[model samples]
Target: MLAFIKRLLIGRPLKSAELGEQKINKTKALAILSSDALSSVAYGPEQILIVLITVGMAAFWYSIPIAIGVLFLLTALILSYRQIIYAYPHGGGAYVVSKTNLGVNPGLVAGGSLLVDYILTVAVSVSAGTDAITSAFPTLHDFNVEIAIMFVVFLTLLNLRGVTESASILAYPVYLFVLALFILIAVGIYNILTGEVPQTLHTPIGTPVAGISLFILLRAFASGSSALTGVEAISNAIPNFKQPAPVNAARTLMMMGGLLAILFSGIVTLAYFYGIVPKAEVTVVSQIAEETFGRNFMYFFIQGTTALILILAANTGYSAFPLLAVNLAKDKFIPRMFLVRGDRLGYSNGIIILGLASILLIVAFHAETEHLIPLYAVGVFVPFTLSQTGMMLKWLREKPDGWVPKFVINTTGALISFIVTMMFFLTKFSQVWSILIFLPIIVLIFHRIKKHYDAVGDQLRLTTCERSPDIKGNVMILPVAGITHVVENSLKYAKSLNPDQIIAVYVAFEREDERKFEEKWEKWQPDIRLVTLHSHYRSILGPLTKFVDTVAHKAKEGDYQVTVVIPQFIPKKGWHNILHNQSSLLIRAYLLYKRDIVITTVPYHLKK
Candidate 1:
C-alpha cells in the first residue's frame, strides 16, 4: 500500500536509461529555472522603498537611481555568467569555476556561499509569498509560518517526482505572473500618460522617521540587489537543458535577464510616478495594482498570480540546490549520500535537506520577509564575485579565441561585484554577522569530511602483502537452547558449509536443565559432540561471548576462520516476537564487532 501511494504521487520510478527523456526544452526550462529572478520584481523594488521610507516621503525619489544601479549590476552579472556558460559547458557555476581556476579553499568558500544562498532563496521567497496571501485575506496572518513550510514540502515532493514533471507543474504560474505584471505595467503607464488620477490616489503617506543621507542610499541599493539572487541558477544547471545544453541555457539566461530588467525597472518607475507608499496592510505592488486597476477582477488576478509565482519561486532553489550538492559531494566536501541518485534520478537527499533547512529558517524568523531580507543578498554576492574572478583567470590562462574581450568583460564584472559584495556586507553587518561566523565553520566541516574520506580510501587500498590464501581450515560453532527443529535445521546448514569441525555449545544456568538436555541428545543419537558450559551469574551471553573470544584468539594464531551459526524462529504475527527471548539476535549483535568471525542465522518457520 505504501509503495502504491508513492507510485501514485511521484509516478513510477524511471529506469536509469530514461534520464535523457527528462531533459527539458527552452520554454519549460525558462519557467522552471528563471522563476526566482522573475519573481523577484514583485518584491525587489519594495525592498528599496522599505529602506527609503525611513527618511521621508520625499526620499522615495531615490528608488529610481538605486534601481538603475541594481539594473547595471544585473546586466554585468548576466553577461559574465553567459561567458561562464560557454567556458564550462558542463554546468560549472561558481564552485566548479573557482575550484578549477582558483585554489581549493576558495572553491569551498564559493560552494558554502551558494549553499547558504540557495536555502535563503527558498525561505525568503516563500515568506514573501505568504505575506502576499495574508495581505489579501488578512485572517490567515496567524498561520504564515505553517503555510510557508507546507509550500516547501509541496515543492520538495513535486521535485522528487522528476525534473521535467516539476517544470511542467510550475510553468503555468510563471507565465501567469509574467502576463499579470505586463498588464499592470502597461495600464499604469497608460494612466500616467493620459494625466488621469487613480481611484486610490489620495492614499496616506508614511510618517518620516529620519533624514536621508549617503549611507541610507547605499544601504537601499544593497537591499534591492535581491533581484540578482537566482540569475546564476541557469549556468549551474545547464545539464538539465535539452540538446546543445549550454546554448539553450544561455538563451534562457538572456530571456530571464531581459524580463527582469523590464519588470523591475517598470515597477519601480510606476511606483514612483504614482507615489505609492509601503503599507502594513498592503504591499507596494498590490498598491500599484489597486491604483491602476482598482478593486476589480484584474486587480485580484494580479495579486493571485504574484502570490503564486513568489511561492513557486522556491522551485528555483529546489532545482539548483540538489545539483550543487551533488557537485560538492563529488569533490568529497560533503557526505557521499548526496551523490547517489533517487529512483527518479534526482538528488533526493539534497532536495530533502534543502527543504528542511528552508523550513527551519521560516519557523525561526516567523516567516517575516524583512527579517530574512538582510540575510539574503550577502550569500548571493559572494558567489557572484568569485565566479567572475574565476572566469577572468580562465581567460588569462587559456587565451582562447576572443579571450581578450572576454577577459576585459569579466575583469570589469569582478571589480563591480567585489565592490558590491563589500558594500552589501558593510551596510547589513549587524544582521549578517551570523553568516561571517557560519562560513568558516562550514569550511572547517568540509576539510574534516575530506580527511575522513581520505583516511578510509587509504585503509581500503589493496596491497600485495595482504593477498595470500589462508593456510588453515574453517570451524563452525552452533549455539542451541535444545534439540528442536530449528536447531536441526541449523546443524544441517552448518554441515553444508563443509567445515573442518562443528561444535554444539549449550550455556546451562541450571544443572538439572543441562542434564535433561544431555539425556535427550543421547536418546536422539545425534552424531555431533555437545559441550556444556555453566554460567554462575545466570547470564547467557557473558559465558558464550568469552568462549567465542577464546576460539577467535586461537584461530587468529593459526590463520583459521570461526563461523558461528545460530538457529532462529520466524513467527506468523509480529506481536508473537515478544514471546521469544531473541537470544540469536543478541549473539549476532555481539559477535559482529569482532573481525574474522563469521556469523550466520538459519530461521525455522513457526506454524502459529
Candidate 2:
C-alpha cells in the first residue's frame, strides 16, 4: 500500500539506484531501523496528551515533565540495546535475548509485544493522519474515521507487495516529515527567543484532575514515553544490515538514538513553548502555524505536511511489526503464517492481518485515539524492558575484563527499563483496563498454541501400522483415461501392493475418445477386469463421481477394502479450459467427506 501510494502520487516507487545500490548499507539500515524511533516526533507528544486527556486541561502541560522522564529512561535503554545489536545481529531481537538468558517464554513476551506495538504504530499514525486532514479540510472532519480506514487498506497492500520496496518508497516522505519537524522547531524557537511568541499561543488547557495525584503523573509519563515505541526495530532487522552485521547494527542503533533524541526533545520543547495541545481539543500546532507562517501559507501546507508525517509514522509500524512476527515464529511463538513470505517479498498475511486489526480498533473506538492509549503501551514496553533486561543478562553472563563497569551500565539499563514496564503494567492493566487485558490474554493463547503444536509433533512417532496391514486379500483399483503408460504404471504399482485383485476402470467420454482407447489394456492389466462405461452424453464428472460412490458403497457391504488410484497428468491442456476443470481439487474436497477409503494420485510427468 505504501509503495502503491508513492508510485501513484509521487511519480514512481524508489528504485535501488535511488539509494545508490542494491545492498542495504549503513545509511539504508539506519533509515529503515530508525524510522520507528524517529517517527515519534509526530506521535510521542500526542500520546502524552492522550494520557492526560481524562484528567482535564492542566494535565496537558504535564507533557514536558513526562517527556523529560522518558528521555532519561530512553537514553539508558538505547545504550543497552546498542549492546544487544552488537551481540546478536543475525536477526532475532528480544527472542534472542530471552532465549539466551530467561528462556523462550519471556522471549516470546518480547516478541509478542513488539508484534502488537508495530501494529498499533500503523493504527495510531493513520488515526493521527485523519486529524491532520480534518484540520486542513473541515469538510473531511466528519469522515476522519473512514479516511483512516481507506488509507490503512492502501498501506496493507503496499506492504503485501514488498517491505523493502515499500520502505524505499517511504524513506523520502519520512525524511520530509523529519525535515518538516526541523523547520517547525527552528522557526518556533527563533520566534520564541525574539520575544515574538505567536499570537496563537494560548495558556495551558485546564486539567480535569484537581491535584498532582500519582496516577496522573504515571499516566503522563506513560504517554510521553510513546516516543520509545520504535527503538527496537533495529534489533529486529539486524539481518537486513550489510557486512559485519553486528558492527553495522550497532552503528545504525547509535545514529538512530542520537537523531531521535534530538528530534523528539526538540518537538516536545517547541510544543511546550508554543502551548500547542492535541487537536482533539485545540490542535495547537496547526493554530501556531497559522500565526507564524500566515493563515494563507500555513493553513494548507502545514496541514498537508502533518498528515503526511502521521501517515509515514504508521509506515514505521509496517516495517517493525512483521519483523517481530517472523522472529516470534522462528522461535516457535506465533503460527507459521507469520513465517510465510509472499511472492512480492513480504509477510503478506501478517501485513493484512495487522492492517485489518488496526482498522477494527480504529472503527470500534470511533477513532477515539486517546481512549486507546492504555492498550497501546503495555505490549510495546513488555518487550522493551525484557529485551533490555536480556541484554543486561547477556552482558553479565559474558563477564569480560572491565566487566564491573559494563555490568554497572547494563544493570542501570535493566533497572530503569523494569521500572518503566512495571509502572505501565500497574497503570494500564487494571481489571477495568479492557484493551491492555486482552493483549496479554491473546499473547497467552498464542503461547499455548505453540506449545500444543510442539507437543503433537514430538509424539508423532511412526510405526508399521501407518502402512496398510491387512494386506493378503486387499485389492487396488485404479482409474485411468485409457491403457496409456499411466495404466501400465498403475498395474506395476498394484502388483507391488500384492492385492488379490487388480481392476482398471475408465468412463468413456466418447466412443472415439482417444484417451479411452489409446493403448493395449491387454498388455497392462491383461488378467484383471478393465471395465469401461459408455458416456453417450459426455458427462464426465457426474458418471465418475457416481461410479466411485457405487464402488465404495459395494465394498462396505461386501466386507472388502477398496482403494482408488487416478492417473494425474503434469500440465493442463487447451481443452481442459472447457471441461470439468480442477478435477483433483474438487474430488479431494468431496472425498474428504468420506469416513475412510483412501484415494491416491499417480502423477504421469511429461518430461520436458
Candidate 3:
C-alpha cells in the first residue's frame, strides 16, 4: 500500500537505463536551475530598501547605488562560475574546487556552507512566496507559515519524481514569471517615458528608525547581495544538462545572470521612481505592481506569478543539495545513505531531509522574509569566496591559456565575495552569529563522519595473513514462553543443529506457574532437558540473558559456540500483533549482537 502511494505520488519507478533520457535541455534547465536566481529579483531589491528605509524615506534613494554594487558583484560571480563550468565539468562546485586546490578542511567548510545555504534557499524562497500570496489576499496572512510548509512538501514530492518530470512541471511557471516581470518592467518604463508617475499603494513611513551612515549603506548593500545567491547553482549542476554539459550550463548561467540583472535593476528603478515603500502586510514588489497596473487583474497576475516563481525557486535547492550530498557521501564525509538514489533515480533521502529542514526554519521564523534574510546570504558567500579563490589558485598553479585574465577575474570575484561575507558578519552578526558558529561545527562533524567510515572500512577489510575461526561444535538454547506449536517448531530446528547440548529455558513469574510448566514439560518427556527460571521481579529478558551468559561462559571452555533460538508466533492479521507481549522480539534485540552467541527466530504462522 505504501509503495502504491509512493508510485502514485512520484509516478512509477524509472529504469536506470533511462538516466540519460532525464538529462534536461537548456530551456528546461534554465527554468529548473535558474529559478532561484531569477526569483531573487522579486525580493532582492526590496531587501535593500527594507534595510535602507530604516533611516527614513530619504534613504530610499540609496537602493539604486546598493543595487548597482550588487550587480557588479553578480557580474564577477557569473564570469567566475563560467570558468568553473569549463574547468570542473563534472560539477561538485565549491566543495570540489576548494578541496582540490586548497585542501580537505577547506573543502568540507565549503560543503557545509553550501548545505546550509541550500536549506535556507528553500526556507527563504517559500517564505517569500507565501508573503506574495498574503499580499494578494491579506486574510490568508495568518497561515503564511503553514502555506510555506505546504509548498515545501509539494516541491519535495515533485523533485522525487526525477529531474525530467520536475523540470517539465516547473518550466512553464518560471517562464511565465519572467514574462510577467518583463511586461511590468516595459509598462513601468513606458509610464516613465510618457511622464505618468504611479502612486504608492502603501502609507509612507515618515519617522526614521535609524540614522543614515556608511554602516547603513553597507548594511543595505549586504542585504541586497542576496540577489547573487543562486548564481553558483548553475556551476554546481553542470552534469544535469544535456550533451556538452559544461557549454550548455555556461550559456544558461549567462542568460540567467542577464535576466536577473535586468529584472532586479528595473524593479529597483521603478520602486525608486514610483516611491514604493514596503508595508508590513504588502511587499514592495506588490506595491509596485498595484501602482503600475492598479488593483486589477494584471496586479493579481503579477502576484500569482511572483508567488509561483518564489515557491518554485526551491526547486533549485532540491536539484543542487542532493547532488552536493552525493559528492560528500562518496568522500565518506557524510552517511553513505545519501549516495543511494530512489527508484526514480533521484536522491530521495536528501530531498526529504531538505524538505523537513526547510519546514523547521519556516516554522521557527514564522515565515517572515525579513527574519530569514539575515541568515540567507552568509552561507552563499562562504562558498562563493572559496570557489573563486580555488579557481584563482588553479589558474596560478596550472597556468592554463590566458591564465592572467582568468586569475584576475577570479581574484576580483573572490575579493568581492570575501568583502560581502565580512559585511554580513559585521552588519547582521547579532542575528547571524549562529550560522558563523555552525559552519566550523559542521566541518568538524564532516571529519568525524569520515573518520568513522574509515574505521569501519579498516575493521571490515580482510588481510592475507588472517584466517577464519574454526567452530568445532554448536551449543543451542531455545527460550520457550509456554508449551505450544511455536515452541515445538523451535525445538525441532534446534535438534536438527545436532549441537553439544540443547536447553529449553522458560521464565515464570509465579511459583504455581513454574510448577505447571515443568509438569507439562515432564509429561511431554522429550529427549531435551528443561530449565525453568523463577523471577521475583517478573522480568523475562533479564533472567533469560543471564542464563545465556552463564551457558556461553561454560561452552567457551569446550570451544563450543552458543546459539539462542526464540519461538515467536506470526499473527494472521496485522492489527492482531498488538495482542501479543512481543517478548521474543525483545530477546532477539538484546542477544543479536553478543559475541559467541547467535540468535535465531522460529515463527509459526497462524491462520485467521
Q: Who wins the TM-score comparison? A: 3
| C-alpha RMSD values across all candidates | 3.3, 7.2, 2.7
Q: Give the TM-score of candidate 1.
A: 0.91
Superposed model 2: Cα runs more than 4 Å off: 1-23, 50-62, 198-210, 281-284, 425-474, 477-561, 565-587, 590-597, 601-608
Tens digit of lDDT per residue, candidate 2, span 58-114?
Answer: 555677677778878778777777777766767677767877788866776666666
Model 3: lDDT of residue 42? 89
C-alpha lDDT values of all predictions = 0.88, 0.68, 0.89
Pick by TM-score: 2 or 3, better one: 3
Residue-pair clashes per candidate: 0, 12, 0
Question: Hey, what RMSD does candidate 1 come out at?
Answer: 3.3
Q: Of the candidates shown, which would achieve the greatest lDDT relative to the real structure?
A: 3
Clashes of 1: 0
375-421: candidate 3 lDDT, tens digit per residue: 78888898999999999889989997789988999999999889888
Candidate 1 residues lying further than 4 Å off, grouped into runs, are 197-210, 463-471, 481-484, 504-543, 572-590, 605-608
Arranged by lDDT with the best first, the candidates are 3, 1, 2
What TM-score, over all chains together, does every model reach? 0.91, 0.75, 0.96
